[model samples]
Target: MANSTLLSRTRAERAAAERTTGEPVGQGRRIGSHLVLVLLAIYFVVPLWWLAVASTKTNAGLFGGAPLWFGSDFALGDNIATLFSYQGGIYWIWFRNSFVYAIAGGVGATVLSVLAGYGLAKYRFRGRGAFFALLLGSVMVPMTALVIPTFVLLSGMGLLNTMWAVILPSLLSPVGVYLVRVYAQDAVPEEVLDAGRVDGAGEIRLFFQVVLPLLRPAIVTVLLLTTVATWNNFFLPLAVLRDPNLLPVTVGVYNWQALSNAGAGGEQVWNLIVTGSFISVVPLVAAFLSLQKYWQGGLSLGSVR
Candidate 1:
């Protein structure tokens, strides 16, 4: 009886200790995961932080001071003024061109992706498997390899050095098409389509009224992806465009960087380059922040379904 009592007391004490301390293995794993996430966050954020600090400094301060921290002389406003006034305000032109290309290309790509993806997911057509395979293969091919061929094709068509040169190529997004196809397959049920058909809805009517609303998340994702891709495209624009006015902010910044790199005779416009780069990132950041909720909702909806 005394031995039994002692065993019960020992078991109770162990349970109490566990309740107080929690499971060590699971707790350690959680801590390790949090540490990894914190490290990754710092890795991504440090560059942006450095860029912001650098943008606030003058050309001399950029070389003299700590790269990650702000300098004594805050020249962000002067830098902005110079950026706008430099070479007859060419930066604004580049900014405008970027907006045009991103919007037009993004919308066009999203539309095509939605249409193509929806068709591939829902319809039973001849050569569908072959078309999808080609798309997957295209996705695997490096975009840089195609830049030369695209340049030649654009040159032959007399589209080189024009906005269409960039925008046209940006519209052909194989990844976006694949993303939309996968999303549509699971998101839009055949039962729903049949129900719409039972209501005498035509294909176009069903697409607009029934199918589109369900694919909102995929559309937003594709739009953001294509827009960012076109905005950041440097090699394509550099290869095709020679005119300063036709260049996007990305290429415009590169031109400034090249001039800054040239020894002695070339102008040192490092301040403008850093400041311009910082400014250029704002629109994309805004776009992601604004559209985040839509995609998040889509994820939740998919999970629930």
Candidate 2:
């Protein structure tokens, strides 16, 4: 009886100690997480903060004053008016061009990726593994390396300086294909495909109606990724398009900033350049924030399933 009582007391003491230790570990984890998140928040917000402050200043203030703080004179109104007036308001044209390329290319890439990935994942056919291997290899290749070759090809087709030059190449995204493939493979089960086959539904109908619905998260992820990538595609557009009218936001902003640096051409329009860059980012930011929830859910679903 004495031994039994001592054993119970020892067990109780051990349990109490474990509880005390676990509580600190949990608290420490939470604290660490919060600290990391705070750091990340600062990392993202700081540049935007600087951009906001810089956009308010004149060329003299931009060159002469502090980077992170506001200048003595706020030229936001004049900056916007000048930005809109530059080159007969061609900045608006660039903005529209970017939107068109991003949205249209994103949609095309997503559709192709979904179909290609779904076909690869759901079907067993000849050259399937080989095709997947080729796709994986393609994903490993850098897009920068393809620019010269893409330019040559587009030149051969006489498509350079046209929207098609950028749009056609942007449509092919190995990363999107890979993501969709992984998502479709897991989110869409073999049993489900078998059931669809057993039903009177055709493959296209089954994919469009059933499998596609299940892969909504992945679709959104691919769309967002493609849109952002296409929106930010500077090198491709730069290499292919010599026409200012065909220039996207990045190229257009670069030209404006370059011209602004040429002090001989009256006074440099620094405020417009800064404000234009700031405004150019608004759509991208909106798109990112809007799709972030879907993006997170996509990654979670892909990982879990």
Candidate 3:
């Protein structure tokens, strides 16, 4: 009886100790997670923070003082006015051109990718494997290495130095096709397609009304990637376009940077260039945030399946 009583007391003591320690253990884990997130936030925000600070400063302020600190004088308003008026308002032209290229190229690439990918995934025909192999091979080739060949081809077609030269190349994205094919194969089922066919739906109708809606998330992904690529594409634009008016924001920014370095555009223009870059980035950031929700929604829809 004494031994039984002692054992019961020990069990109760152990339970009490566990109850007291559990809350601290959970609190410690939460603190660790918060610390990790804080560090990650700092890592991502640091460059943007620096850019914002630098945009408001003169070149002297930029080159002098603490790198992270704001300048003594706020020249942001002046920078905006100068950027807008630079080169007879060429910067605004470049901004519009960027929008045209990004949106047009992105939409074209997404449509082509969806059609090509869905066809490749759902249909089987003679030489299908070979066709897919060609696509995979195209993706493997370095785009930079093909610039010269592309230029020559465009030259032969009398399309070099025109917007067509840039837009045409942007339209043919093997990587986008490949990504769509992979995603569609998993996300879109053959059974659903067969059901559409049984309902007397034609291929075009089925694609737009049925499969395309189902592949919204992948479509958004392709669109965003293609947009960013086209917007930031510098080498191709540099190689193909010599007209200052035809230049996109990336090349236009380079021109500004060059002028600033040569002291050709005056000292104040340096701050203008920095401020322009800061403004230019805003739209891209907005695009990502807007599309990100759609991406998440698509992922959830797929997960539910």
TM-score of each: 0.84, 0.84, 0.82
Task: Score residue 97 of candidate 3 by CA lDDT.
Answer: 86
Per-residue error (Å), model 1, residue 184: 1.4
lDDT of 1 by residue, 110-144 (tens): 99999999999999999999999999899889999
Report how far residue 87 has shifted in candidate 1, in Å.
0.8
Model 2: number of backbone collisions: 0
Candidate 1 local Cα displacement, residue 134, angstroms: 1.8
Ranking of all candidate structures by their lDDT, best first = 1, 2, 3
Candidate 1's TM-score reads 0.84
Off by over 4 Å in 3: 1-27, 30-37, 59-67, 264-268, 296-305
Compared with the true structure, the alpha-carbon lDDT of candidate 3 equals 0.79
Q: Which residue pairs in candidate 3 collide? A: none
Question: In candidate 3, how many Å is residue 206 off?
Answer: 1.2
For candidate 2, write residues 247-299 as lDDT tens digits. 99999989877776776576477777788899899887876688676766554
RMSD of 2: 9.9
The parts of candidate 2 lying over 4 Å away from their true place are: 1-40, 63-66, 262-264, 299-305
The lDDT leader among the candidates is 1
Clash pairs, model 1 backbone? none
lDDT of each: 0.86, 0.83, 0.79
